[model samples]
Target: MSFDPAQALRLAHDTLDIEAAAVLGLKRRLGDDFARAVALVLGITGRVVVMGMGKSGHVGRKIAATLASTGTPAFFVHPAEASHGDLGMIQPRDAVLAVSNSGEVDELTVLLPLVKRLGVPLLAMTGHPQSTLARHADVVLDSGVEKEACPLNLAPTASTTAQLALGDALAVALLDARGFRAEDFARSHPGGALGRRLLTRVSDIMRSGDAVPRVLPGADFSHLMREMTRKGLGASAIADADGRVLGIFTDGDLRRLVETGRDLRALTAREVMHAAPRTIAADALAAEAAEVMEKHRITVLLATGADGRLTGALNSNDLMRAKVI
Candidate 1:
């Protein structure tokens, strides 16, 4: 059969509207039960063991991940697998979040008795409060949807969306209650770009010791250029004998000097240097270094210690190589 583009677009719009309405419907129903669910999970001493079957199981897995990543300890378990032995993973200190739109999946209902016997707090996320899962649950979260986004009104589209939204709400509520910060999130995601931005310090990627371009304030232009070339940082710190930074000179300054047709041989580091150059603490995050560089329109930053002594130096290239920019 030939397809009509207008009909297809209308169908897509209808589906989105239905799903969006279903999620919006959840807002009115959220009240004491949602708060109780959050309290139960927060009060638990162990992880949140989430279980479901079929599409609900997929949503359960995502909910578990969101919870774990956002500071709450949680993991997903298959209802069938739980009966086989995975049930051992659920301890009395843990809370069980069971998802079922019907609240009557035989695979899940069958485990309800055992979950209760284990003395674990059971939280049910279901559409049917009268169903077996909700009846046995210690706290019931109404994940009911007015309808599904499917054309046949049978698939788990709107309901799943509601479930996912509810899950996100729970995770964020727990995150706020626990005072979870970005640094804590970064620690859990160290291998990702966000983690590097938050956890990587200037000291971790800065060129230190001999690699840091440095010259005495009285050093000649040739000496400063040599130091910049040797360090390959495009900039050099002009410091005193005690290693305190006096100023900074960059390749940009060199270009300006050349453009003016100045006598380069007679110029000293102190004669043409940016006094009180942009500096960052060695312990500052690389993300902050990137910010300082962008804000000042400078390519290099001198890292200093608490004692106001030059500790290291980093350029835009270093930030890029470290994946902090």
Candidate 2:
């Protein structure tokens, strides 16, 4: 059959409309039963054991990940596998969350009695509140939808959308109840961009010790240039004997000086530096350093110790490499 472009576009729009309605319908039906599910999971000492079959299993896996990342301990256990041996993965302290639009999939229903025997609370996310799964559940969450988004009204389209939205709502409510913070989320996602921004400190990414370009006030222009060249910082800090930053001189300053057409041989670090250069606390967040650099329209920033002494130096490249910006 030839593809009709206009028909395909219309179907896409209709599918989205149907799915959106299914999710919105859940908001109206949400009440005491939803609250009970959240409270039951919160009171549990062990993880939430999620299980399902086929398409529902796919959504169950995603829900488990969302729950685990948002401060709730959870994992997905395939229902068919439970009969073989995976049932051991579920403990007495854990709560079982089963997802099924029909709520009577044999593989899942077969395990319900065993889950109950283990004294694990069963939370049902199903369209049929009176189905076997819901009948066995300690808390029944109504994931019912008017119809599937498929053209034949048979596929698990709108039903899955409703399940996913309901799962998200539960995770959000639980996270808020637990007071889960962004810093806590960063700990769970150390390799992600948000993690780098929240957990990386200026000192962690800045060049410190011998890598920091610096020269004393009495140093000649040649010495200052050599320090900048060796460190490749494109700039050098002019410091007192105790390593307290007194000034900063950059390549831009050198260019301006050369434009003057004056003799540069007599210049010392103190004679050519900009005094009281902008600095950030060594312990400041790398994200905060990025904010400062963006606000000042500068690439390099000096990191200072408590005594206002030079601790380290960082540039835009350093922050980019750290994935903190």
Q: Estimate each model's TM-score.
A: 0.98, 0.98
List ranges where model 2 is wrong by over 4 Å. none
Best-fitting candidate, scored by TM-score: 2
lDDT of 2 at 18: 98
Model 1 Cα shift for residue 223 (angstroms): 1.6
Please provide, for model 1 over 25-129, each residue's C-alpha lDDT reduced to its tens digit, 9 standing for 90 to 100. 888899999899989989989999999999999999999999999999999999999989999999989999999999999999999999999999999999999
Error of 2 at 51 (Å): 0.6
Ten contiguous residues with the weakest lDDT in model 2: 260-269
Candidate 1 C-alpha error for residue 53, in Å: 0.8
Instruction: Please list the C-alpha lDDT of all candidates, in the order they appear.
Output: 0.94, 0.94
lDDT for predicted candidate 1 compared with the true structure: 0.94
lDDT of 2 by residue, 1-325 (tens): 8999999999999999999999999999999999999999999999999998989999999999999999999999999999999999988899999999999999999998999999999999999999999999999999999999999989899999999999999999999999999999998999999899999999999999999999999999889988999999879999998989999999889899999987788889999999999999999999999999999988889999998889999999999999887
